[model samples]
Target chain A: MVLDGIAKTALLGVEMGMTLVLVTVGLTLIFGMMDVINFAHGSLYMLGAYFGLTVVSVTGNWWAALLIAPLLVGLLGGLIEYFSIRPLYGRNPLYHILLTFGFAIMLHGLVTEIWGGQVQNISTPALLDGSVDLVLFSYPLFRLFLLGVSIAVTAALWLAIRQSDFGIVMRASAHDSEMVNALGTDVKRVFTAVFVLGSVLAGLAGVLLGTSQAVDPGMAASIIIQAFAIVVIGGLGSYRGAVVGAFIVGMLNAFGPTFAPQFTDALLYLLMAAVLLVKPAGLFGNPEAT
Target chain B: MSVKDIVGRHFSAHAETDVLSGRVRLGLFVAGVVAVLFAPVAQMIHPFWMDLVTHMFIFALFALSLDFVFGYAGLLSFGHAAMFGAGGYAAALLIQNVTSSALLVLPAAVIIGAIVAAIIGWLSVSARGIYFAMLTLAFAQLFYTIAFNDIPAMLLGVDAVTNGDNGLVGITSLTLFGMDTGSLMSYYYLALVILAGMLALVTRLANSPFGRVLQAIRENEDRVAFIGYNVDRYKIVAFTISGAMAGLAGGLWVPFNSTATTSMLHWTTSGELIVMTLLGGMGTLWGPIAGAFLVVFLEDSLSAIGNWEIYLGIVYIVIVIFAPRGLAGIFQTVRSNPHPKVLLSRVRSALVTYREKVFS
Candidate 1:
């Protein structure tokens, strides 16, 4: 019985952690690469799910929805970067905060107008249906498929950011954009591309999780706060910190309800407050970076 | 300047009321005229208009409080609704358990608001800008969870002390020294009185030497620190003062509605607070008041469609992009130019500048 409980908890934790990391890495990456703390990132994630839902509804194919949603969302992301964000580059970051906040609300209002403010659900493909019998416990097959997708995406991200020739340019630019631009890299194009990539990650998370949860516009505001907490707890200062933060938040989210259902919501917020109190720069973030 | 205006300068609250720039005085005088003229006519039509206007007064006071911290102190707090809710919840609980007297309940609410703000401000003042905003947000959400979960009621095993979703409700009508604020007009008078008093008080404070330092800090924190000011202390003080004011607004609201709910502490309220402040022209004491009136009026008239938020967002984006200083900026531009041709050219040039930046 003990082994079973432990295994169950571990599985739930990893499942949650992977999904959260996938969601927030986009946020952390945008901040890391472009110096933009996007208040609209969560809205983008919600939009991705909405887009995926629409595609699936129209085509009756989950795989097609999965393939096309990110590309569509990524294109929207590119436009937002080009039109709004580019103009505010040299201004105080507060303008970015306010602008993105407005964007979030506008996107919300737009979605509600289209979707009529109802909770939505996405059905899993037949291949990923039913439960799988594991050694310690029974688990849902769709969740396992999701777990597989997360690992594959994570591996692909690692290779792209750490192993490719383009990765070298991105790393160099992150450290010293002026130097990289002087070396003949088109820094503007790089910024737009990075923003699109982050948006793509958000879209992918939305599509993956859309299968397992209820989809609603209200989720944007709530999830964004949770994402912010994870980003901060891991350290808003770096990508690695965001991943670590995601893992911790995922575990707490998975286990808090089982043990103390009444305090689960409060505990996540309290965890964030305690972190800020002890270290304002976050556990992994550098104080002076921002 | 006219002799009347020159003599009025000494008694004026700030430079906006100076003899050379009489627009704010004009604006207030015009507003007063409109209210006096519009009251009886609204009463003849329906009492709903009076209630809506009263709500506007409450919201204006809340927005004014936000402007004090966000505009002058340059601290963008996203969790200000928590203080408002704290004040509201305190007042409702007091009316339920202690006394329903306006005199006692309102003051208690103010104190509760100040205490909550002080705790949040002290914890949040360590970080600047975005981090400060996030810290305030986190702590506010902590209080929100307590309310949403009804922790007080749960812990005490008292049904009355909890926020069982709809918060505290069905309170008795407000009494001021045994007199009922029975009618919508009476409540309107009460709200107007409170809003006016708070507005005048904040205006006086904003023109003080302390206020100047706060603005100075907003403009350049490094310089203010280099000049040997304790910047964090100043921020905390400003935050607490604003919290007290927003709390009073919340207190006034609970009496008007005869209830308090989690909506008072919700992020949407906070977001609307920001919208009102920015729309009215942040940094100016009276701009938020005008903004509040405009927003409430629009919400009253257009909320039937349920897509008002879309329009609100569009308005906010336009304000941020074109009129960063909002209505105040537009009034100033038109007042300064006075001639259509010159104003049009200046507007054209500004548009051209933005286009260059966007397309570059």
Candidate 2:
């Protein structure tokens, strides 16, 4: 019976890990390439959930909303980059922090103003509503779907980055925007694209998370802190680090409740600190920016 | 002369005029003290205003600590509320379990706060700039979790320690040197004394060699390091001191609110302090205090109508664009400007700078 319970816990950990993988990937991507910090990433995630919920609620088609919500969020992200973020580049990094922070507050205020400050819920579509019966226990099918999607997306992302022309330009720009610009690349477009892509990924996390959990205004603030912890542990801007870090964080967060629920957040931080103590640059990160 | 040459020549001509800055500084100091002394009188007219003043002082304490980091040391901590919450929790727990003497408990809270700050600051100093900010934030969240679990009354039925989500209650008021801090007047005075004391200490530090070293580090960290100063050690010291001060404010907060809740440690709390410090004019001893008043007042006034956050967002944007030096900056500039004082011209410039930096 104990063995069965342990197995179930492990499964649950893996499921939670998948959710983290989605969130941290985008976070790692943006922080790695742009040096943008992007405090509003979680808000974008929250927006995705809200957007997905709204569309699905209106049309009663969760799948369609899942596909469309992130695209809409991408456009919003593009606009934010153009209007607010683009001007602040090459200035004091604190300006970026403050600006992004302002953007988060603005987004939260607007979200609350329109949606009200109450917790909102959306049902998983019929295809993934039921649970999958395992030897030990039953698990939600939707969670498994999320797990599969995250893995698939991660693989696709890896491929695109490895092979695509845009990805090569992205890598070049990430190395040095000034150099890339001098080489005749439209650095502005690349930055905007990367911003939108990062936001859309956050939006994707939001949609999936909303299916698993209730959506609320403060959700962005809480989730972002954890996402940040994950990225830091994974090594800022390291995609592989983010992937590995996400699973570790997810598993720890899931199991922390059992060991000591209150210290769940602390446990994540402790783990990060421990990793950083050993490898300050993160597991996958190069010590030097070069 | 060109603008640069003209400005440079005027600056050289007015080298002696900078001495008059001392007079403006003294005047501002007296004005500030007078305002604090008279501020509680507004409470007699309306108790809420007095309570507001008390809160403002608490925030001033918080913002000033932030200035030590962001203003002096060039470290932008996004998780300073951890210290604040730690102090609050310490005072609250002490009140609940041990002695209720405000003197013993508050100082104990500050000491404990300093210890926590030292540990977190030590770990975080390895990184710089945004990385440092993220590390501080992560450490704060970790600290928050520890408070929730390790401390009683925080969570997990540890009511004896933290009192959990319901928060520590029945916290006895300050009996400082045997005086009842329960009285609003007494509490206000206590807060005032502490705030003024902290401000004085900060001013001393800012003017002292340590403060100069900090500013030097801020201006050119690499050079300071090359000069053989363990730049990380200095950063850690500044971080630790700022954390302790943040804790002191937090400790006072327990008695002020009569409870210390987990909410105090949230990132928003840290964010608010950052806003206050920036709005007042970072690096200036008085800027944070001024910022605390302005921000707290604005928040209180604006939250009633909604769109408060948006307004604040706009204010932050505007400050970054126009008044990067903050309210105290305007006064400092005018007092230092070597231009000949003409009829209405000096007065108009002062007013513009003041409004541009402060009220705007």
Worst 10 residues of 2 chain B by lDDT: B13-22
Cα lDDT tens digits for candidate 2, A1-290:
88877777787787777777777877777766777788888889999999999999999999988999999999998887776676666678677777778778778887888888999887899989999888678888998898888889888887777779998887778777799999999887898898898888888888998988989999999888888888888788887888888888778867888887767777788877776677777887752231
* Candidate 1, pairs of clashing residues: none
| TM-score, candidate number 2 | 0.89
Which candidate ranks first by lDDT, i.e. highest?
1
Model-by-model DockQ, in order: 0.68, 0.33
Candidate RMSDs in Å, in order, are 3.6, 5.6
Question: At residue B88, what lDDT does model 2 achieve?
Answer: 90
Docking class of 2: acceptable
Candidate 2 Cα outliers beyond 4 Å, as residue runs: A134-136, A260-262, A287-290, B1-24, B33-37, B150-159, B321-323, B327-360
What's the true lDDT of residue A147 in model 1?
81
